[model samples]
Target: MLSPKKIRHRKTFKGRMKGVANRGATLEFGDYGIKVLTCGWITSRQIEAARVAMTRHVKRGGKVWIRIFPDKPITKKAQETRMGKGKGSVEYWVAVVRPGRILFELGGADDELSMGALSRAVAKLPLPCRIVKREEL
Candidate 1:
């Protein structure tokens, strides 16, 4: 699992996802990319799993860039616990993703290879995504 080395605050208020991604919406680092199509919380473990799948599929033929990082800490209460003891302990880290966000980028590989690797990565993610190319950006 991926987590911040240091956190200024352990608990934070729940924020709203109100708009589409404005920045990092285009493929900048690679010729092919995976663009997220839904809004959701992407866990750190899921990101690592996707990365491993892509790396194994690429087999050193390309470079992959992970655009999102799990920085937000989510809290959860213990089962059978009372409901009034503040919020809850931080349970895990997640990246809040919105529609139109480019989650991963692949470079140095041919179209077929990149697409295959990206598709494998997509299976590890929790939300729906699309494989895109630089020209499509």
Candidate 2:
């Protein structure tokens, strides 16, 4: 799982995740990428799982880039614990993913292999995603 090695804070409030992604919407380091279609919290484990799937599918054909990181910390009190006992500990980390955000990118791979790899990555993600090709400008 991808996590920050050091952090200034341990616990944080659940913030809002609205509107489309303004940053990281276009492909930067790859010819093909995966664009999300919905807004949600993408866990670190999910991101790693998707990356593993893509790498395994593509083999040695391409270079993969992960555009998102789970910087936000999610807290859980405990299993069946009583409420009102202050905030819980940091349980996991997540990335706030909005529509149009590119989560994964592939460079140097053929069209078929890259697409297949990205599709396999998509299946591992909880959010609905579509593969996007870079448009020459």
Candidate 3:
């Protein structure tokens, strides 16, 4: 799982997802990309899984760029514990993803290879996503 080397804060409040992503909405590093179509918290585990799938599918023929980082800490209390005892410890990290955010980009691969790899990656993600090209931006 992805985590910060050193975090200033251990726990944080659940923030709201207000709008579509304005930044990182376009592909900057690759000709093919995966665009997030829904707002949700993407866990580091999921990200890694998707990355592995993509790389394996592409046979390492292309370069991949992960646009989002799992920097936000998510806390969870012990099961069956009391309701109130301050916040729980940080359990995992997540990236707050919004609609229009480009999560992954692939370069150096042909159209067919990129599409196959990206589609495999999409299956590993929790939210619905669509494959896009740099020209589509």
Per-prediction TM-score, please?
0.93, 0.95, 0.95
Q: 1-137 in candidate 2: lDDT tens per residue?
A: 99999999888878888899999999999999999999999999999999999999889989999999999999988989988989998999999999999999999999999989999899999999999999988
How does candidate 3 score on lDDT?
0.93
Query: Once superposed on the true structure, which residue ranges of model 3 sit more than 4 Å away at CA?
Result: none
Mind giving the per-residue lDDT tens digits that candidate 3 earns over 24-130?
99989999999999999999999999999999988969999999999999999988999998988888899999999999999999999999999999999999999
Whose lDDT is higher: candidate 2's or candidate 3's? Answer: 2
Q: Quick one: best lDDT, which candidate?
A: 2
List all candidate RMSDs to the true structure: 1.6, 1.1, 1.5
Off by over 4 Å in 2: none
Where does candidate 3 clash, by residue pair?
A: none
Candidate 1 regions exceeding 4 Å error are none
Q: For candidate 1, lDDT tens digit of each residue in 11-47? A: 9888988789998899889998899998999999999
Task: Write down the TM-score for model 1.
Answer: 0.93
Deviation in angstroms for 111 in model 2? Answer: 0.7
True lDDT of residue 15, candidate 3: 95
